[model samples]
Target: MARYKAPTTRLRRLALQLRQLREETGLSHQQVANETGLVASTLFRLETAKTKPQLRTLRTLCDLYRTSPERREELEALLRAASEETWLQPTAEYLPGPYAAYIGFEREASALHNFEPSFVPGLLQTEAYARAVIAGSAPKASPEEVDGRVAARLKRQELLTQQEPLTLDAVIDEAVLHRLVGGKAAMRTQVEYLREASRRPNIRLQVIPYETGAHPGMHGSFAILRFEEAQDVVYIESSTNDLFLESQEDIGRYSLMFTDLQELALGPEATDALLAKVLEED
Candidate 1:
């Protein structure tokens, strides 16, 4: 069955604003439900952006919160915007839960701080590198499914080449370069692409050598996405439930971790040299 999730930029903003309004009133979900005759669960879904908010419902809640006209109009606009196509469109409805949301956020982000201990970051991955990573990890997926996924991923790489490209600061583990995902030849190609991509003004790539033992990033990979207009978000990929951490505290921890990794990792010049060496050895 096809999922019906729309692009979530405007939806996400509405979610945050709705939660903020509710918090300002200091009313429990149950209290608001009772006053408005709305179900508590429905309110939860609305605040979390799980459901497309009905206009009547939004109006009722706005009344309950005693929102000023200006603030209410802002929210109404977001609701209207949610129904429109967003940048990238979040078109792959079959993308796993929260995965589409992450892509949607990435599309609108101004800058990204990424730490990848396993493979290259999606934004930096070449088509072949992405194909190897996808196919190797999900051997059971049909060739058609793999092809579709590979295409979707490559589409994301466009963000890096766009006129106003997303600024990417990525710290990749040294071992990632050595992994011959598609074969020795394919890995070499991927490394060469990385060397070229690193020189782009929008991308800042670094490599952490094997000598950096048991670092903060050893446990897992995560990304901190910063927006020009909104608060920062920390994304942690998981086998089961991928997480989007929006709290200031969570953002702080991940930001500091990336800073530490950046300091420990080689500079761009060193990274270029290291990739050159890997290509020679391969």
Candidate 2:
């Protein structure tokens, strides 16, 4: 995704820029908060991307920072981008709490590096497979809720076909192929879909064999999204929580892990063959 569409990153980018400008003037967060009369926590959250900054607050910071006209205008543009109507806004009520932010970034990502040790990534799942997985995971969800969630998931896949397609490089553990989430038929169709999706020019799929046990990704499923202008973000998921990491340190660690896993997993051609083999066995 590009910065134009990923407002979540725009917020983050603006936050980072604000922090940088403050640092350039040798002003601490506490000092800036005191000068601006904004609470320290507010400045902290703005810098950390935990909260969106209001235009007034931003203008105050720019004034304090004594930003050049060109730089200030660029920051204003970023602020506008941050407030732009995001793709996630329409389905806001249905999406899981943190997922809206994640999708906001995902929508504008130019390339995605995803690793799933359990199930197929959402972007690659067939509708029936998605429904089955959702039903199993959220057993108490009303049928309407389940349908809304399914629709939202399917809608997210539009990024793959958008005017500027998102290039996806995915690595799945062999266990994902073995676990039957939706029943045999659903699983069968899911695998078939993976095989076809992998063939797309923008998609790259790999599988880590059971033999390559105990890898970095064994801990959980995570994705690294790359944007045209914003720094890369890493998303880590658990049954109960979703986390997005943008720090250079965090990005570096996940980036290396992904590269290592890619080296250890089957290449694209072999992965396709493995998918075909799994389909036949199923």
Candidate 3:
């Protein structure tokens, strides 16, 4: 089944700030709820990001929290950004859970660090490569659904080419290049696409050779997204489940893992050469 996704970063940030401010004021959730004429559960859901806070709610919380004008402006700005129409929001019902949130974060991220031990990272995937991956992963999906997914994924690639693009640092395993996702021809095309994408100034691509064997990335594929004003987030992707980690400790572990992978992986020059070689063999 395609996962259901809702953009969560803006909402999450606003919620966290509200909770923090309330705590700083030494007001319990119930106290704030009573003062604001909101149910405790409603306030709890807002803070936990289970519900999006309305503008009225935001103003109320801000007033109760005694925020300075500058702080209040920042919080309101965050609310606006969160409430804005994200590319994926219209299709959130069709996306996988947490998947939409990840894309939402991707849209606003200043930089992205990706470690892929499987197929190519989605941001770097070509249309054909994405179709192959999506088809193989969801054999039972309807043709229309498949087309929708493929379209959404290709649209996601716009982030790479947008004016003022995000910096993408990707570490792809050697096995990923070796694996034939589409047919041999399609795989070759995907490799060539990767080669070209790697040449872009905003993208830094590396390949970890097979000889490295059983590395830290064996645990699974994960992405660390860094934002301008929002907190850093780590996304862990597995076959059956996906997790979003925001705690500093979780971010640290993934950040260090990417660093180690970068150290162990081939340099850009060698990575280019390796892709060229793989293409030749293909």
Candidate 4:
């Protein structure tokens, strides 16, 4: 069976609310199941976002929980939203469950703030650089599979150039520029691409020098995606999976971490100057 990806913004919010309501009411999954005549595992799956709940099932759950009329209406709206296909459908065949969630969040984000500690962020990677990274990371991937991912990633870049382009503030650890992901020539071209991308009005690129040691974001890389109406989400990627945080508390913590990283990073002018110096070394 294909793994189920977590729902998009609206659906996620609804699920969060559902979980909150269950907690507030002090109802265990088994208790809720007993009240609603649904299986405990089914209730658990719905709350944990392991499965998408049907509209009727959602309405029943809300009714059983005695949710506010306004909140119920909001959840119904999310149910409607869940029925729509995401823009990331093209890459669904290749993307794992967690990655599918990332693509879904990327599609709706009005602004993206990302910090990369090891390599260039996906949206900023040049095609050659991206191909090199993918080749090195997934040696077993077929040529066709690699091509499909590269195409999808490049297409995602168009979001930065659209009529209503997303605001992209990307901060990179200075080491990423020096790491040579694709060897000397490829690295030089990648640095040049970053330099050009930084010139765009919608993009703000900064670099944190290696000298700035032991920062709050040293643990891992993350992106905070802000949408117009939905709450901001924090996406944290690991070697095998990705986690999305939507709770106000978790989002606030990640936001603080991003702010600290931003403060430690070089200003755009200085960052651009440093990038030029790196390119010269190549």
Q: What CA root-mean-square deviation does each model show from the true structure?
A: 2.4, 3.7, 2.1, 3.3
How would you encode candidate 2's per-residue C-alpha lDDT over 65-167 as one tens digit per residue?
Answer: 9999999999899888888887655556666766766888898789999999888999999999889888988888888778877887899999888887999
Q: What is the Cα-based lDDT of residue 15 in candidate 1?
A: 86
Looking at candidate 2, what is the lDDT of residue 28?
Answer: 90
Pitting candidate 1 against candidate 4, the one with the higher TM-score is 1
Residue 198 of model 2 has an lDDT of 88
- How far residue 95's Cα lies from its native spot in candidate 3, in Å, is 1.6
Better of 2 and 4 by lDDT: 2
Cα error, residue 216 of model 4, in Å, equals 3.9
The parts of candidate 2 lying over 4 Å away from their true place are: 1-7
lDDT for position 106 in model 2: 90
Higher-ranked by lDDT: 1 or 3: 3
TM-score of 2: 0.90
Better of 2 and 4 by TM-score: 2
lDDT at 267 for candidate 3? 98
| lDDT string, candidate 3, 220-280, tens digits | 7999999886789999877688899989999998899999999999999999999999988
lDDT (Cα, tens digit) per residue for candidate 1, span 1-282 = 155353455787798799999999999999999999999999999888788788889999999999999999998998987877644344465366477778888888899999999998988787888888988888887787677778778888888999999999999999899888888878888998999999999999999999988788998999998988778889999777799998999999999999999999999999999999998887
Using TM-score as the measure, what is the rank order of every candidate, best first?
Answer: 3, 2, 1, 4
Error of 4 at 154 (Å): 1.4
Q: Which ten residues in a row have the lowest lDDT in candidate 2?
A: 1-10
